[model samples]
Target: MSNTVKIQRPKIPQDIKPLDFCPNEENLFELCIIRDCSIINEDIHRIRFEQVIFKNVIFKDVSFKNIELTDVIFDHCDLSNTDFRNGSIHRVEFIDSKILGLNLSDASLGNVFFQSCNANLISFGYSKLKQVLFDSCSLRNADYYESTFTKVAFKECDINEASFERTPLKGIDLRSCTFDRINVSINDLAGCEVTSNQAIGFARLLGLIIK
Candidate 1:
């Protein structure tokens, strides 16, 4: 089976300037561009960012709960160990970002793209993802328990030791991805596309000897 599906890229704003400090009263930011900024160890909650472009930004160990992100593009950013729980992220793109150990539990993500990102140990438990694309990302040991995926694509990703319990992967293509060990039920793997070698690997997972 061929994996020729192209992921939808982010729609970035053209006219944007260096984002200054946001007003403390309102956590609402729109059409702003933030680059080379470090907001590490900061607790930012209930913030709403619209049409924002973050490039080479560092948000390490930041707490970003209950945030709303719309039309956001995060390029070459470090969002490691960031708490994005209970957040609403729509039309967002994370490209070439280091999002290792990021927490996205109970978040609602729509039309999101995670490309060439180091997303190891990332958590998506109980999250709702729709039209999301994870391309060329290292999602090793990532957790997706009880999460819902609609029109999601995982292309050329490393999903070794990833968990997908109670998450249905029907109609999802896994031909371009590689996984040595995955935690998934047989029923959840139904209607999923895989390569011949991957099929053999799956057979081994089922304790079947393939000659």
Candidate 2:
């Protein structure tokens, strides 16, 4: 596979009509099927999506901050430039979603699974992530600075240019994952393995001169 990441839009259903109002209980079923639809330049502040299945939906430039989601599945969604900042998500699965330019800073994630997703440039700074599995996701340029990770795994992922500055990396194995130029100041990198360039990148994060 080429390293060039291509941007693909989410595939929306043909039968569903466009959502003109804030999400409610009755119309949520139809809205769930409306994937790849753009919510640009609009404010979706504090909309609660409980037990919702948002399959293949595209949320661009929308704000989902301070919202509560439970058992919601966002499959194959394009969440680019969408803000989930300070939201509460539980038992949510983001499968095969394009999460580039997504702002998840200080969000609370518990029992969340992000499988085969492109999380490039997604920020998790100062967030609370517990039992969150980012399996086989591209986390390039993603920031987890000062975030709290518990029982999290980044298996078989490309974490190039990701920032973990001052983030705790205890027991986080980098053997299965690949890194290109991850920033890692104040992170425990003794057990992590890297190439020559990645080693230099780690040192640069620490501001240390390698001999």
Candidate 3:
């Protein structure tokens, strides 16, 4: 029951040099490897990636405003509907990435690690996630409004209709995650650690007629 976040793996220096996402010359990219490029619908602003490694990059319908990623590693990337608004990601590693509707609104992520990512409707509004780890991620309809989570972890995530409104799922651990219907409330489900049929489907979503 511990998601003790520790993702700092991307201090790459195996002589990587294929960096080419040129929106008019250098945007401070260091130790690079950006392969199989396809930057469609571009508006790349304030781009800065360090210790970069992005294989099979696509980034369709790109916006990428105020971007600055450190120790990046995005293998098998697509980044569909990529906006990444006001971004400043650190220690990033998004393996097997698609990142559909990927727009981290007002973003500021640290020690991020997302494996097997699809990330459906990924939009962390007012985002600020620290030490995040999401394995086997699908994250259906993800949009954590007013998002601010520290040491976040969701393994085997699907998160059906996900929307943690005014997000505050303290020390969240959704019991090896797999959501049916989610749009969190009830004081953000204090110290949320669900299972046992997601606490009777959250007690019938607070109607409480479960005999």
Best by the lDDT measure: 1
The whole-model lDDT of each prediction reads 0.87, 0.72, 0.86
2 or 3, which is superior by TM-score?
A: 2
RMSD vs true structure, all candidates: 1.9, 6.7, 12.6
Candidate 1 ranges with C-alpha deviation above 4 Å: 1-11, 21-23
**Candidate 2, clashing residue pairs?**
none
Tens digits of lDDT, candidate 2, 60-117: 6688677777766787888887888888878778899999978888899888888899
Q: For residues 1-211, could you state the per-residue lDDT of candidate 3 as single tens digits?
A: 3544676776778988896877656767788798997878878788888998989988877887989999889998999878888899988899988988899888999988999899988998989998899998998989989899988888878989899998998888888888788898888888888888888988888899887
lDDT comparing candidate 1 with the true structure = 0.87
* Clash number by candidate, in order: 0, 0, 0
Name the runs in model 3 displaced over 4 angstroms.
Answer: 13-18, 22-30, 33-38, 41-58, 61-71, 74-78, 81-98, 102-132, 135-152, 155-172, 175-192, 195-198, 202-208
TM-score of each: 0.93, 0.76, 0.34
Question: Of the candidates shown, which would achieve the greatest TM-score relative to the real structure?
Answer: 1
Sorting all predicted structures by lDDT, with the top scorer first, yields 1, 3, 2
Give the alpha carbon lDDT tens digit for every residue of 91-157 in model 1: 8999999999999999999889998999999999999998888989999999999999888889899
Ordered list by TM-score, greatest first: 1, 2, 3
